[model samples]
Target: MAHAAPRSGRLTPGKRDRKPDTDGSPRVSTDVFSERTHLVVRWVLPVLAGLVVGYWAAANRRSGGPVTGWNLLFGFTTALAFMVLCVAVRVAASRMKRELHALTWAVFLGGTFGFVYAQTDKTALRSAVMAAAVGAVVFAVLFYRYYTHEDAEGHRVP
Candidate 1:
């Protein structure tokens, strides 16, 4: 069988090879800012939430209920639960690169907290609810920015 000449047209022009950098290794870009921000939310938001709860107990749980101490204890416990839930969601969202979703969840949780506070006639709980609501809003905005930044960087969130 006769061999045909190599077809130069099959080869495309401007082919570039991407090699490892000067350290003789491959470096992957992992956006740590989002992770760090999420970490902050995990710890900071919960503590703030706990404070809000304590303040709520001090103000509202102080009256109109037998065993004022017990009332305050319950209020604090509820707030701590909220904090735990929020931290869990924050971690999940950060991993998924969907902070907005987490923030939305936080807002909903704040409202749930508010309902309990209002229903129980606790001023401190009410105050806590208000603070958490405000924080949720801020977190939502920050998370939106974080997601946007990640998208621009061509990160595949999926």
Candidate 2:
């Protein structure tokens, strides 16, 4: 009789082999943890980042202002709005199969930040100028990164 094959309890290999591909990069991981990490990075992290940005915006606006229920309301509402914007951008980029124009989004965020900051009895012009300058730098860096890392189809270049 022919010998039976051994049944090892280990997981099966993925579509790609363990060896490096033509680009000298390892194959994408199919591990369960890796998948979970990807999900968190893709979805949860963006929301969390939005929350942080919103909180900062609200706090900046509230500085030296009245301490009332309105403060709480403003903070919560701003956080919700920011989170929604982030999710929208992510969805749109995914559907379009292209990298989101970080510069445009950065300008939007900076304008939001400046508007909020200007509400705290500060000079609106100064606040806007500062925000725009920072936004420009952010735009430049993100543009370079996205351009280099993604192809025209917006697919990541491994």
Candidate 3:
């Protein structure tokens, strides 16, 4: 019997490699963990952040005092409120124009900061002014980022 020739790396007229073409474009993620990661980021991270903020508020309010039922209640309540408002703001901002979206987050940040600051015995006027300044700065920064990173149709630029 005659022996056949060994296969080589060269491409033949009737055969093509199964590997996909790589044209330097981004590839879609096929990993199963990606969806789980997205879910955790979209929900769990925000909840954890809210809890941290709540703890900070409670600690600031306590001011070296021992932990009490009232403190726990206040902290959990603040956490719940913060989470709800965060979700609401995210949903609302997603549907708004770019300007409104930036403004929404700015307002949320400023209001949350002001609330936390007020726990430190600061004057209401002082907290308000600080919050306004913070909001202005946040708005300017976010607006510029969104304006540059998104196209006219609001889609993100690659």
Candidate 4:
């Protein structure tokens, strides 16, 4: 049998020859501004969310009176604590192989709500029950989102 010459056309192009996302897909170009913006958003958004939750908690948990020094102190303290939790959640999410960010946020929100409710001279049991119920719903929705959007190995898929 006679051997035919190897065809170069059948092989894929070298890395240098392949253009970036020229195959009809939208191409995302990230510059320094984009990168910085992403970083800022990553940190800032969480902090802002934490601050909001903290304020809500403190406001609701306050004694029946106008805002006072103690209320301000409590709000600031809660805000600081929530900021820490947010940062911790960010770190945890970065380290996880699976999607758990939603769970982390849910826990924070639910716990804050429960704490504030209990502080209102309400029954601890009732506060806990309400928090659990809210947390469960949040968890279910977020878990469903994670499940449908991510594969078993945690890689996102369409």
| TM-score leader | 3
Ranking by lDDT: 3, 4, 2, 1
Expressed as tens digits, the lDDT of each residue in 1-158 for candidate 3 is: 89986434433223333444375433332333555577788998779979998998899899889999999899889889999999999888877777888999999989998888888888999999988988999999998988897776676653
Provide the lDDT at 153 for model 2. Answer: 76
Candidate with best lDDT = 3
lDDT of model 3, residue 158: 36
Model 3 stretches with alpha carbons more than 4 Å out: 1-33
lDDT pick, better of 1 and 3: 3
Worst 10-residue lDDT window for candidate 2 reads 7-16
RMSD of 3: 11.4
What clash pairs does model 4 have?
none
- The TM-scores, one per candidate, come to 0.45, 0.68, 0.76, 0.69
Against the hidden true structure, what lDDT does model 4 obtain? 0.69
**Residue 146 in candidate 4 has what lDDT?**
75
lDDT of 2 by residue, 74-154 (tens): 777887887787777667655443335666666766776776677576786899887897778777787787788688877
lDDT of 4 at 74: 85
Residue ranges of candidate 1 with Cα displaced over 4 Å:
1-45, 61-67, 97-103, 116-140, 152-158
Steric clash pairs (candidate 3): none
lDDT of model 2, residue 105? 64
